[model samples]
Target: MNGDWLTRGRDGRLSVYQLSGEAVRCRAERAPGGPWTAPRQVGGDQRLHPFLALGQGADGYVHLVSWRPTVKGEAGLVHSTHFRPRLAALDWNPVGHPDKKGDRTGPPAVAVDAQGRAHVFVRNKAGGVSMLAQKEKGGWDPWRDLGGEDVHDGLAAVTGESGRIELYAAVPGGVLHWRQEEPGARPVRQEPLRAPVRPGTLYALATSADRTTLFHTGTEGELCAWRPGDKPVTLLDSAGHGPVSAVRCELDGHDCTLLAQRSASGRVAFAAYPTEQESAGAWWTESGPRLTVDARVCLATDEDGRVVAATLSPSTGQLLLTRRKDEPGLALEAWREV
Candidate 1:
């Protein structure tokens, strides 16, 4: 299976990682649409999934994690996820073993905190959340259990108002929140989200201004968001859109949220949610330029607040970068083929 993923480093370069069968291909640029470096392949086998999770550490290294799929006729195939995580510099040079023991039930998600520390979370073998923190220099702390039973799918994390990084998981009943308030907090605080959430990936964003928004794909596949202490709000009914994301941005000198989604038809779209004081909905809904694909899995915004995307091609089974035309608006730009 092929995978396509995008992330930004401290240097403001857009780093793209594409998985084709067993090889991982990488390319980076000072910025999206800039002169991309020559692509290079990292060794691996087809058993590995291409939908890798990526984050940039405060130390200036790119961190990635994806587990190998279970193979039939193997002793632990039914209970295996075999994770071999990697850490790379801005240049895409990797440092890690190709095979590590672990299991993951969903696509991984990662985030970097204010301290430049990299925090990664994934659903583990027991359908519970497992996390690993990258040390200042290199190496990862042993995967720690961030307990949650029946944790359905995707994982998300955000640096909270108090500068504490909180991780989220979707369980059958509601969204689960986990966090350690301080450096040596006793037990990781766990709480229930205000409302019921779908079993897909959970997305959370905490603005620097102290506003937090929680969004997810509902049981009916509709996009939903809820503010803390409030009822869940349905943003849009599903029409094959999956993998929702909200990134911190600026509009008219105020902090905003930039959202993106991939429709089942392979068309990727974007919308803008200005400050809560400004509106209750997207300023311009799904009006951005779109990229056609076999499946769009990853959508991210870089340090410059520009949205970037990637997708899988059913025909060629390769991952491709989705770029936008140099137009004025965030979602209004037309797509430019690279």
Candidate 2:
């Protein structure tokens, strides 16, 4: 359950992270299309098969979250850390103990705001949501319960222009939504925005402009996104069981959202928006390439329009990074693993 495994720092560095072996590690390039440094262990308890969330604050600090499914990390705790985007290997500022009682249910989602505060949201074993925040200077605050029930995992969070932070997760009947308009302000609403799609894999289109659009595999393997208004937009006719992710890129002067999905064969594919600027509300998909069975996919943008992805291969349980360029007619070349 990785929220965003690849983040672009303010300094133009591209940092790639993944759950490697018993700990989480990161690899970075000095700038776009730059050479990447060797993978370096940032920090985490010695444990296997843990989940992670990653975000970069306005201050160019990369925030990391490492938590377990059944228990916390090896030290039996959910932990977090922050470090300079470029000099991360030289130093790490640990913001430990997400919950005082160390209670957790699944991997956490993180978002850092303009004031350099880190916000984390996660669902506990009881299916209630809890959040922990850490400001620029102070340590992590105590966990606060944001009441909701039976919320599925894969919580998503985003910060808005006016200090607004939004979080959403799947509930029994629909999505449970919450918002904090400003700092120190309580959540304005906590209710479900009806629609039950796939369970366990809730993906926020972090690649979308408003972050309001979400995509997940439907119960019957159909891919779904937020319709222009309330209804969900089902894209394509070949949807099958797969993983979903997206990246914002421009192709032939058309700024578009590149949607990636793995087919039953493990091949990833693509689709775009605004194909003709006013062709009605139609979204179509095209085949890309498949991945080996041992890999779980994650996508990122180089921020310069180059689409990048990193697949975690079980061979070494490390990221196998790839870069793809768009071809005419929205078709994509084979993903070249870097």
Candidate 3:
């Protein structure tokens, strides 16, 4: 239940998905805070991977993509959609392996374009990347190979303010990027960007209409930022050990960006700064009881425009929720199990 597991729908209702055993479970918030529905099983139990990728389209539907063992014991992607906050999720739809050999692939990352097509990306068996996207008319287009070798497993994909999809993957010396020149078009690979990022820590934030900033833990654990053609900027001195969850929202009428990550000691750490103003500075503040087991924190803006963060209790396996208080400077309410 980490890495983009929480999604807020256009209706203002928030949906959180997590892997419980081999089955996917979903919890819904009527609005931002209280009276969240009890966890409901998404699909039948299967040999599904532990990862789940959640993406919301402009149409208000939340699209999910996950890997599950298919024929020959190789993993294939499965797709599902929750049309509305309180509605039952659609049945799992199978997206076969990228190649005919049923090659084993890594967990899939998804982004739905303005045209409502879901683009799924995964690290292929050959150490490169492959993508399978939905077609406008109805069905899905065949899997297309988006070439990149020496990349890591976790793929970060997001739709920009202009409705184009952009992707970032961490490689050895730097990061690889791809962006759609136009909305609903194939994402073309851009020049290899420079950043000594630790793989699996890459996250993308659409700070403005035409701009997306990539954030990741540097090879030395520093939280770093890089937009196309710009030199890498250190957002925080230390971002801890995993992928950073970020969201841009209006904080007290001023635009701001919020970040959350798992601290090195396994506690949830948070930071805030003015959007696109990396030089303004940000400091990490640790909160919540340190997890007794491994877990990650996810950030999203609630219906009330307050920042909402959630994570699983590794010891009890219960969901914990917290929200930013109305007052100044990213103050969050106490963490309470929901």
Top candidate, metric TM-score? 3
Rank the models by TM-score, top first: 3, 2, 1
How much does candidate 2 score in TM-score? 0.81
Note the Cα lDDT for every prediction shown. Answer: 0.55, 0.62, 0.81
What is candidate 3's lDDT per residue for 1-338, written digit by digit as tens? Answer: 32477888777888888777777888898765658898887855556777788787888788888777776656677888888878888888888877755646677788888888889888877788888899889779888888999878778898888878989988898889999997667789998887577888888888987999988888777888888878889876674777888999888788989888878777888888999899999998899887755676888887778889998754467778898899977788999988
TM-scores of all candidate predictions against the true structure: 0.73, 0.81, 0.94
Mark the regions of model 1 whose C-alpha exceeds 4 Å error after superposition: 1-4, 30-33, 42-51, 58-60, 68-107, 160-163, 183-187, 209-211, 264-266, 276-279, 283-293, 297-331
**Candidate 1's C-alpha lDDT?**
0.55
Tens-digit lDDT track of model 2 for 174-250: 77777786674545555466766666556664333343556666666666665224666676543345446666667
Give the per-residue lDDT digits (tens) of candidate 1, residues 73-146: 21111101111112232322222221234333566666666565666666666777766665657655555777
Candidate 1 vs candidate 3: the lDDT winner is 3
